[model samples]
Target: MEIITINYPLQGLEDKGPIRPKTLAIGHFDGVHKGHQSVIRRAVDVARAEGLEAAVMTFHPHPKEVLGRGSEYTTCLTPLEDKLERFRSLRVDIVYVVTFNLTFAAVSPAAFVDEMLRPLQVKRAVVGFDFSFGAKGAGRAETLRELAGSDMKVDIIEPLMMDGDKVSSTLVREALAGGRPETAEQLLGVPFSLRGTVVKGEGRGRTIGYPTANIQLAGAYVTPRLGVYAVMAELSDGERYSGVLNVGVKPTFHDSLPMPVMEVHLFDYEGDLYGSTVRISFISFLRSEKKFASVQELIEQIGADALKARSVLSAFK
Candidate 1:
């Protein structure tokens, strides 16, 4: 898949001469969750039936983050690289990562079409029903269609629901934050995962006979609820191991730290995984983090947690 980082004001495209007509799936696409997958799939279906290039346009830094809407908007469910990977998996031919800044946000609905979509020869655009654009987000999905007129067509997908609840990124976040990864998986159509590199930590786990791989998150991701969970780790070589993942400070030993530490003890695995990239998928919440009275007590509880994690993970297998 071709990934293009289109700068603001849409520069350097003149050299290509006439652009190819394409069908674009445009959105923030934070998680590429079930609802997002539907929109992108529809765009691909439309592109294939119409014999046009299947393309996607996603904004970076999120509009809310750039606009200073709220502090909660700072982190992301999926980073830019992760989002691109999902788009590629959806069989999108091209992905345009548009820079979302103060200047571009000021572009009116009509001007956005006249300046960007028209130039790119976007014949059709697929967006969600609640999609908005332009300064202060004054343009709705209907506004885009009207503004584009004869130059471009628009399709707006309605809200997807599960168990009478809307399937959305916000709901996904809430689920993960509340230690409900099963619900998140239902919304995402896959397990909620965190990717990171194995980093060195204080060799305390090894002394306790429960060696763990300390993880350093790859990017700014929304941290899952702080506690222990049943998780599976996929190494760089594609080996997967089910394990007990802890997402909190070692309350039993240290004082409250500024940031929580993420560490996992994979079952039936023993190797040097330092510097390796591991993707950990949250399977189930085991228990909340607590401060044990003694180190042996903590050790005994961890052994129990391991047994419970193994039992829960077996069903997933």
Candidate 2:
């Protein structure tokens, strides 16, 4: 599989030379939730049937994030790294990380097809039912079909529904924000997880006898409601460990800081993990964060959380 970054000026894309008219899947694909995956799968199947490369075209920095426009949302389901990994897992041949900016955003629909899609020799294009492109999302699937006509193939995948409601990134975000990990998982096709490198912390958890590995995260990632959760942590080497994680300030200790923190206490194992990248998959919510009356009470609560986590993960190994 080839992963290429295509810059502007259009003609330069040919440096790699003209490839086959690959089937292209286009979208913002913020989370690549179940619904988005439906579209991606169709594109891959079409590419396979036509015996052409399967390619995905996505933007960087998310258009809204770059434009400093729209509601400042928190977190993306699949960050850039995770998103690319997921695409590769689906056997995609190439992913063109289209740099999104004011200039690129202003390109007209016809110009986009001619310069971007046509140059890539896109024989077929697949997107969501409401997918749009070209300057403020002025182009729709219908418009793409109109512009390309029979010369280019186009398919618009309808929304995927689960249990009546449409599966979507927004719903997943809402679920996570509300501490509904189980619900979020239903829509994502897997448990919700966050990946980052372990970093040093204030030594609070350590002092309390439950040493923890802190993680630094990126993306507009949402913090699961202020509480403790049962999670499975995956190391870079693919090792997995069941752990208990707290996502909030130390309310029990009366800390007034609003900055949320993630502290994971790995069950039954301990070694130097600092600087090591890890992915923590949320399994279930344990309890809401609360203000304990004293350090003893806090310790007791943590002990209970450890017990709950143990029970939850007993069958995982």
Candidate with the greatest TM-score versus the true structure: 1
Lowest lDDT 10-residue stretch of candidate 1? 11-20
Quantify all predictions' global Cα lDDT against the true fold.
Answer: 0.92, 0.86
Segments in model 1 whose C-alpha atoms lie over 4 Å from true places: 14-18
Any residue pairs clashing in model 2, and if so which? 74-220, 75-220, 75-221
Top of the candidates by lDDT: 1
Model 2 stretches with alpha carbons more than 4 Å out: none
> How would you encode candidate 2's per-residue C-alpha lDDT over 74-143 as one tens digit per residue?
3567878888888887888889988887888888898898888987889999988888888888999889
Model 1 clash pairs are none
| Per-residue error (Å), model 2, residue 89 | 1.3
Cα lDDT tens digits for candidate 1, 1-317: 88888866899976745578999999999999999999999999999999999999999989999999978779888998888888999999999899999999998887888888988889999999989998899999999989878768999999999999889999999999999999999999889887999999998999999999999999899899999999998999999899999999999989888899999999999889999999999999999999999999999999999999999999755
Q: What is the C-alpha RMSD of each candidate to the true structure, in Å?
A: 1.1, 1.5
